[model samples]
Target chain A: MAQIRCTDLTLAYDGVTVADGIDFTVNAGDYLCIVGENGSGKSTLVRALLGLKAPTSGSITFGDGLTAKEIGYLPQQTEIQRDFPASVREVVLSGCIGRFGHSLFYTKLQKDLAAYHMERMGIADLAKKCYRELSGGQQQRVRLARALCATGKLLLLDEPTAGLDPIVSRELYSLIEHLHKTEKITVVMVSHDLEAVMHDASHILHLKKKQLFFGTREEYLDSEIGKTFLGGAGNA
Target chain B: MLEMVFEMFTYPFMLRALGVGVLVSLCAALLGVSLVLKRYSMIGDGLSHVGFGALAIAAVANLSPLKVAIPIVVIAAFFLLRLSENSRLKGDSAIAVISTSALALGVLVISVGGGVNTDLNSYMFGSIYAMSGEDVTLSLILSAVVLFLFLLFYTRIFAVTFDESFARASGVRVGLYNMLIAALTAVTIVLGMRMMGAMLISALIIFPALTSMRVFKTFRGVVISSAAVAVICFVVGITLSYLLDAPGGASVVLTNLAAMLLFSLIGMVRKS
Candidate 1:
């Protein structure tokens, strides 16, 4: 069974429809990249998938033991984070907040889990450092480590490389791809970066306020819409 | 100076004011870190205005002010949170509208009930002598509750304040935690109003956090320093106010202002 299935989904807010008739399904170990232009409801879809916003119509169901709470999320950075006073360790440990059902503090096991992910993301040495003091790439790595701590099964990342330069963005993409291959974690990424999407994603779901295409990477490469988008995207 | 401090401590009213002031300041500083970082610093000010309006209504109706004001201010906090989350008028605009309306309502009610008297003056600028034993007891209990809840959910609160979307996705019940912060702020505002006044109570909430943020680079450091700053300022402000015959709330606010400037200076010096 598919890990997540969204059937005929329509998203709207403030009396305005943003996207309509969105349909997709993610099977286990699938590397799905959602590509779209600005205002194409890509963010809206990410929010819906995380169960933060309800769809205006249709349904989203999880199978293969997947639940909304179990999907690790690496959200885009916000203004609040720019000057936030928190250590890398503290921020990463916060990802384990969901595991504390009724406990007031984190357990030893959760701490170890956070530590492991931080080491995996190569940020263990920076654990005691202030998060905001780190460079943009390092900050994203810390966030990614936090996301890994949240869930070991799946990840939902929104524009994870929105700000970094080409070198750092490529490095982050490679890290994500390594996680996908070795850990066998399902990935759902929202991005505008066609280069990374073309190089890494196993499946593509293109959007322009609607589902323009949803198919395998080979199928997408051969499709007319994909060719047009890739050409237009490549020039820019 | 030591003898003067000893003299001030001899009075029963002074003792009560110090006790309540310490607890209220501690609660405000703890919540302030999250509020300041979340850009909801003005929330404390807004809720204090709602508290004032509630106090006015209670005075006119001959009811217990704390009892009446607590629930009204909490409900208003919830309303403000909901408005900011969903309404067209987002955060600061919503807070401004509600705060001004509530302040106006308070003034209107006070004037209709005859005129400004010692009760109004005491509530507006704050008088240490206004800290009745009963008010102290209530403030103690309420502040204990605020502190307990804050510590119990400290990590969750940190998560929600830092990143709401990620916290929500991680199954942290983001809405509940946000409401928890709002409700605690309401209770702290009401409790501090008798000692700090509605006009100046939010200084207790904002100044220490901002001052600590100037020097601290970590959340735990910021939180610990904010609490210490709050307690020291309260003690100093109370002492200065008693000695100089100044309004208690204004004295504290001035003390906080001085600390903020001093910390900013230190931060700049360290950077250079």
Candidate 2:
């Protein structure tokens, strides 16, 4: 089943269209990478998909009446957020709040789930450590674990590798790829790191101002725009 | 110490003032942590000025200041909330515009009327000595309501504080929560005005929260510790005011500042 479907979607702020008339779909277990330059409505499109912003026109439907708690998201890091004083465990547990509501009481299962995800993300030892004190790569991993705790069926990540060392970026991409393969979860990611995204993406969606091109990796490799932007067919 | 307690209990106004100060401080401390986290420490300052303006106007018009101030401040807070969301006006600019204009208008109204018989000094710097039983009851009721709301919306509040966009994405109504916070802040400003007065009210809102941040890791811990700190400051400040015969509002703010400094020193020592 298609986990996400957007039909004739248009998004605008203050009546100026950023991206318009977009049509897209993601099947279960599909790994789709949205590649675009800055100000090309990449983030805007992701915001619309996450329901953070309403589309000016068109309909977006998720499979089986999936609520927000069923979709995990990793947003781009900001300096202010990095300086926020919360422990790693505390940060991750916040993801479960969608399920737990406003109650201070937490079920044993929820606590165990948070711990399990942290361990799975290889940050179990840093659970008690302050989030602000972690290395950039480590912080990103913890955020990923936090996102994963909320939902494993579908994940939306925006600029997950931006501003990180190339090695760390590669590791993050590899981790996402591993999750896609092992968990069979559908993933939609917005990223400027084309090489890493193109390497793992089964499907590529290229976005420019008011335009979108959706195709398989092979088709993207054959296209003139993709070839020019990505450097070569091999890279695509 | 025993004699001092007896002196305090013997005076009805003193007992009432203490009750009002402690209750308002507790509620302010709880909300203050979230306010600081959201980088809106100045909001309390802004709203209190609005409250003061309403109070001056109400005093001149022979209306109950509490009745007039509550709705006016709440409306002003709503306006500030909406203005902040405009993305055109920066957050601080919006706060400055609302607060300064409201305060200036208030001053104009007072001056035009040649000032009411009310002592502005007490309102400006807080005269906890003048608190009546009605003020104490109002403070208690407001604090209870605020506390209930905070507990009811704790999870959504945490989500919004951590990441507003994320909270909205998770099906929480971001606009509703923002307005709710603004309204609560307005209520806090009005309730606090009686104890700390307009001039020094925000200090009560900010100091305890900042001091607690040095040690607390979780949001809940911050709230708890902030309240504890605020209660300490209020009790100590009131006691000192009684002994020293100083201004109650200024004394409370000074006490809060000292506590902050002491905590910072203790934290430094631990770090070293």
Candidate 3:
């Protein structure tokens, strides 16, 4: 069964159609990369998938029992959030709120889960440290741990490596790859770095203005548009 | 100090006013942290103007201001929320339009009422010396309601205030929560008006939150510390007003401002 399926999706703001007649499906454990230029509706599509924005004309059907609590999301980090006053532990604990919503108090089990995810993300030592005092890479790792605590089955990251150093970006991608392989979690990522995405992504969704190309990486590489777009690396 | 305390307790109005002031200040401090963080600190100022307008209209109709103010400010808050959701107006612009119009309408109503002794001075700048028992009761009830709601939705509110999109993605209803916050702001503005008044109410809401943020590491800490600071400033300011024979409302606001400035200076020194 498909983890997420969108049929004939159309999205707009103030009657201006940003994306129209879009269709996509993601099976369990599939790694999909969405690549596009600015204003190509990458964020809009993610918002629609997360139920933040209602598509104008489409049906988005999640698998049975797969609610929002089962979907991890890593949105783009902003400068304002970097200076926000919170500890790493507090931020990560927020992720567990989906499961523990308004319970008056958090149980020991929830704390353990939050700690486990922080440890898995290699930030257990920084749990009590101020979030703003952390390095950018460390912050991103904490954010990932937060998302992981919220959901374990599917991870959706929106431009997670946009402003990081090249080494940090590579490390982030490797960490994502490790999660994907080890946990068999479905990963849907939006990124502009085509080379890194091309190497790791099993499938690609290349979006242009009102156009979409969805296929396996091999199929995408063999296409004429792929060759033109990827500088003949389609043959690789 | 002992004599002043005995005198204060001897006067029923003074005791009632002090109770109202402390309760309203505590509620305002609790909600103010989120407002400051979201950069909507002016919301209290705007909503209080709406409350003032309602109070003036209620006076004209010979109705209770509390009853009239609650519904009017709540309706106006919903309208402000709707206008903010409209991408064209922007949040600050919406607040500016509503608040300015409401203040003008309130002043106009007062001017046309045959120059009667509307006691508009108290509403504009507060007059704790004339507070009644009814005012204290109203404030206590409103503060209790706000505290209960805050406790019930603390986690959801934390998520929405920190990162709205993340909260929405986690299946929390961002729009509902936003509306809830606006409604609470409206109620708090009305409840606080009898003590802080409309014009200076925003200061009461913003200053304590700012001072606490310099040292507190968590949202809950910010709320608690700000509330404590607000209560202290109110008590000290009231005492100073009695001893110095100055205006109580101005004294209170100035005390809060001094505290904020002192905290900021300390923070700068530590950083340096």
Candidate 4:
């Protein structure tokens, strides 16, 4: 069953059209990579799917016992967030804010979840370290841990490897691949790297201003839209 | 020195000033951590200028200044937030535009309606001597409300201050908490304007957070230490002004600055 379905979605910023007539379905346990060029509204589409922004006119329906609030999101980090003064523990623990409901403080259960995710991310030792002091790879891992504490069922990452070196990017992809294959967390990601787009992605949703293509990785690699992005190397 | 300290609080005005000063300082410091983190620290300055304008109009119209200023400043804070959200202006630029224009309007109100009065001195540059018994009562009630709301929303505030987008996606109502912070800050700044003065009140909001940030590595640590530092500085500043016949607002600002410098030195030593 589809976990999330978008129909006839159009996104705009201040009346300037961003993307129009976009449709996609994220099936349960599917690894969907949203690939697009710069200014092609991949991030915007991510925002709309996460319910952070309302599409100009369309519906984002959640099914399979899933809700928008239950989705774990690793947002693209901004400069202010990068330099924020928070400890690794605090950052990860806050992912349980939604679970707290009206409670003023975190419960022991939430703390344990945060700790578990920290261990999973290999940053358990750095729980007390300030987030701003961590390296880029460490920070992204910390963020992934935080997102996991939100929901270990479905994870959404936006440009998780935007600034990392090739080695670190590969490591992050491997970590994500482990989560997808071993833990069975459905993964939806927005990334700029067309080269890294094929690996582990069950499906790809390539977005542009007017055209959007969503299909299996194999189908995408065979299509002209994917050829345009993946280039001739898609065959190799 | 102990007797002199005891003597200062014996007077009703000094007692009111100490009570209100400490209360406002604590609120300002608590909110300041988030404000500084969000890079919206200067919003306090902008709102105080608006408070000054409202006070001037209240004086001319013969209304209670606190009553008049609080709502206007709160609305301005909300307006500024809206402006930043919808308009192209950033928080700092919106603050600059609103604060300067309000300050100019305040000057206009004072000059056109009634030439500089003794009241203007106390309002523009605050005086502990100017705090009335009525002001003390209002400050007491408002301070309690601010403290209550802050503690109640502590978790939400911490989350939003760290990463608003993540918090929002996590189902935290970022807008509601942001408004609560803005309104609380507006009230704190207005009340503080009576003791810290319109010109210097933002210093109350800025100093403690910056000082604590220099020494503390975590948000909770910074918040707790900032509040402690604000209260201590306000008390010392009040006492110093009373003893030295100094302007109360300037005295408090200087005390905060000294504490900030001390924290900076400690931070340097630790790093070295």
Best by DockQ: 1
1 versus 4: better lDDT goes to: 1
In candidate 4, which residue pairs clash? none
In terms of lDDT, the poorest run of 10 residues in model 4 chain B is B83-92
What DockQ does candidate 4 have relative to the true complex?
A: 0.77
Q: What's the C-alpha lDDT at position A31 in model 3?
A: 92
Q: Against the true structure, candidate 4 has what lDDT?
A: 0.87
Model 1 C-alpha lDDT per residue in residues B1-272, reported as the tens digit of each score: 78988999899999999999999999999999998998888788889988988998888877888889999999999988887767434777988989999989988898798543437877787778778888788778978898788788888888898999888887778888889889988988998897788899999999999999999988989999999999999999989998898888999999999999999999999989
Structure candidate 1, residue pairs in collision: none
Instruction: Please identify model 1 stretches exceeding 4 Å from their true place.
Output: A14-16, B87-89, B115-118
Error of 3 at A142 (Å): 1.5
TM-scores of all candidate predictions against the true structure? 0.96, 0.94, 0.94, 0.96
Clashes in model 2: which pairs? none
Q: Could you give the CAPRI-style class of model 4?
A: medium
Candidates by TM-score, descending order:
4, 1, 2, 3
lDDT (tens digit, per residue) of candidate 1 on A106-172: 8999999999999999999999999999999999999999999888889999999998999999999
Better of 1 and 2 by TM-score: 1
Task: For residues A140-186, write the lDDT of model 3, one tens digit per residue.
Answer: 99999989988888999999998889999999999999999999988
Tens digit of lDDT per residue, candidate 4, span A93-164? Answer: 988987887788989999999999999999999999999889999999999998998896899999899999
Q: lDDT, candidate 2, residue A61? A: 89
Give the alpha carbon lDDT tens digit for every residue of B100-165 in model 3.
Answer: 899889888977884565777887987776567777788888889878988888877788777776
